[model samples]
Target: MTTWDEHAAQLADTVTHPRSRWRDAIRATPRHLLVPRWWHNDLTGTLLLDGPTDPHRWMRAAYSDTTLVTRLGSLHADLAHPDDRPPWWPSSSSTLPSLIVRMFRHARPETGQNILDVGTGSGYGTALLCHRFGDQHITSVDIDPYLTATARERLADIGHKPLIAATDATGPLPDTYDRIIATVSVPRIPAPWLAALRPGGRLVTTITGTSLIIGADKTPDGGALGRVERDWAGFMGTRHGPDYPPRLMHQFPHARDQDGDDITTGRYPVLDIAEAWEVNTQLTLAVPGIETHFETDGDDRTAYLLHADGSWARAHGHWTDAPTVHQSGPRRLWDVLERIRHKLNIEGSLGLYGYRVHIEPNGRCHISQGGWTAVIE
Candidate 1:
């Protein structure tokens, strides 16, 4: 049987180059310790896997370059029973190792710089940072007290004593830092995060509802300017409390099969909006706060778009065929999706990558690329 050290070495080789600065850190840290148990989602439901009970499977999962869901809703996998199943979406996860390396590369932290690691879900990222940089220069924060406490203990057990605090990342941070890298997504850059940046500091994070990774340097005007990275990544949105607000599930049934106020045949084949990251990003930028759901029964596919404002749209059809769309409420949801698809088909891309980003001191972001511009408030 292969040991965890061997697995870590293999993972290091897979995710980083031989000369990569992160290679040593990845190989040194024991991920299995940080994530002793996690939830594995299958076609049936989310299942809990305890590391001690199945060491081989646990080692395989922990060392793999994959995100491990550690918590669903308010229930941590450690506390869940064998048969326990939470209906909510994943609220916390140990982000994939490669993406963590990518975000750190974007931040470009140096030896003497103080770093803040936001959303310390499993403390795996924090452990890597502690290994690469000294523990004294690292501070990690998460909203859940249980997560922080457990992570702090687990990290200490591994001979790392970084400051791990339980605090809302969207609000005031504990202290200022030269580099801030968030594993969790935010609706926009938090004003406190902007205020907490030291002079000549930089930040790397992803926008909520999109797979956009942005890196920005502190500006003399107390703001920051940067651009959307070419690489795409997604993270769970930051929550202020134990769990996120209930999903927009209440609107699903009505939008699932019922006739809508407006009906039409879609100009294109039915597509899973959530799976089409770029198209989904465009739609999110065009209309914020929209929720999407997709399902397929055999060859018949159905997609639904719902909003908190009581607007909904459903598209149903056979695979690769034009869908019959039903839309209702104040705005035609299907029309918006169609327009975005049309733009992608004509332009060949959404052009979100490399877009210039200007963030105000108050955290409002102005993103522009050529003739296109949008603001996130």
Candidate 2:
């Protein structure tokens, strides 16, 4: 039998440096207690795993550096029956240990400084923080009452107690902190975050709909200035309620095969926009609020792009071949994608990384690199 301590040590060795300060914290924390039950997706469908029933598999999963989804739609795995199948989209998860450590390293918190942990999902990250710094310097918050309450109990069982609260991180926070790190992604930096950050404080988070991780330091005028990190990370977007709103899936069916106002042979092969992180990021910056879906049957592939403003585009063809694109509404979504691809081909890179970011107090972001600039309002 592999003891959990041995597993923890192995996990620590794999994810962190031998001399890293976080190694000890990772070794000391027991991850299984925080996530006793979670949902696992396999080829057939989503499956629920009950830890106590299978201790060996539980230890392997809990200690491994992989995210475990704990909630689907509004249904929590804890409250669900063994036979129930919740929605496919994950609402909350215990983020992988390495990513948590990566974000912490970006913040670079020193001892005796207060830290706010946003999106208290499994409380595993809070436990690590308590072990690294004292519990007195840690505070974790989430919008879901059940998540906070359950996390508080689990944390207490592990002999750690940090201030755990049910509050919306996008709105007013509970108190001031020297560093704020959010596991959930936000479309824009909320104004309340700037006000809650102490002078000379730092904030580390990811922008929604992109894999860009931002590390910003507070400015004198209650704003922030920083740049996009070279490393990329993706997180679930912040939600005010139990689950995110319905996706634009209704538009997908129509766009799948219907003729559009304009049709043409695409200059490039069909691309899965969701999987191409850099291309997806650039497209989000160029045309915000677009939803994408991709499907494949045999060697033929189809990709659809839909927006709330009655705009849509569909491209379909064999893999590696130029697709036939159909587009409608005010914007030509496929043309926009081609223009972006054209730039990528011409420049050899998108230059999204290392872009300078200037955030106003109201959370409007002015991002630029060289002569190019874009605003996130």
Candidate 3:
């Protein structure tokens, strides 16, 4: 097999663009050092460990561009020994390169502007910023002190020393910056981010409500104005400290265990959630706090939707069942999902695409769509 560096080189060659300057930075920096310890998450919680003790497995996992979860649910993956191969989902990771590059484009930092990076995952991004603007002009923050410390050491190993702080970015940022980029998604764009930007400065971040990428400039009037980049980039939502709010096991106790009520058969295989963002987001506008899950049992398929208001719905059907049938509660959850799906199919897509955010001086956010038609609050 080719050496890991060879793979990085190949990817760098293929992805050349105005955004490709970071490619060289990616190739030059040793990503493995920055992510020596990481964690993964699962339905139960996070599993902490040093991934793949086998030298071969370690090298392959370390070099691939895919994000590796280093920490989850208070378990640091780096801390786990080699003999232990624990099953867990990814909680935090070195985000995918394409998404990272799109974000850099959104920040639009000039050669002279100072930059701040929130969520110093692997310090890979910090090095990229430092490569362009020098370490003096970049500041990186993470909620975990160990992550910041590890990032600092590895960054220094590469001779890049942008500030890596162990602090909560949701609170006051350490300093004002000409550009701020965050790798974590937040449900709401924190008000302090607007306060931290210098006039005309840009803030590129993911809006938490959906997988929306927003790029806005700090106006002299104080609101930030920018539009969503046309891509889907998901990062773990920001955590106040070591971990985010735990998954509510009881919220879906029946999800994996008991048979659900109003359970009709399902016709579709498990669909990727990313594919439903537009319709889902649109539906959320009509009905908030509604979530969905899908499952399959060889011959049959099932989809579930739950709302905090104690309403739930389940749809069960197979190819044989056609005509997509299902059941619902006091509020019909399946109807809402199917309606959104149908609306998307009719419109050829959902309106959640290509949104623009207008942050007014008072911190109220106004979102708009094509032709800048603002979404009413």
**Per-residue CA lDDT of candidate 1, range 274-374, in tens?**
88999988888888998898889999999988888888999899998988999988889889999999989999988879999999999999999888899
TM-score of 1: 0.98
Candidate 1, poorest ten consecutive residues by summed lDDT: 246-255
Model 2 alpha-carbon drift over 4 Å, by segment? none
Clashing residue pairs for model 1: none
Q: How well is each residue in 1-377 modelled by candidate 3, as lDDT tens digits?
A: 67657755755554445456677766666666676666544565644445335545555666665677776556556666545544453446777666676788778788888898999977777887888788999999998887788889889987998888998888899999999899997766788888988988998887554666777889988778877677766677787866655443347666544554554534333343435677656655556556666677776766566767767765555634642444434677666666667766678877644677788755566677656453422
Which model, 2 or 3, shows the larger TM-score? 2
Please list the C-alpha lDDT of all candidates, in the order they appear. Answer: 0.92, 0.92, 0.69
Candidate 1 segments exceeding 4 Å error: none
Candidate 2 Cα deviation (angstroms), residue 83? 1.6
Worst 10 residues of 3 by lDDT: 265-274
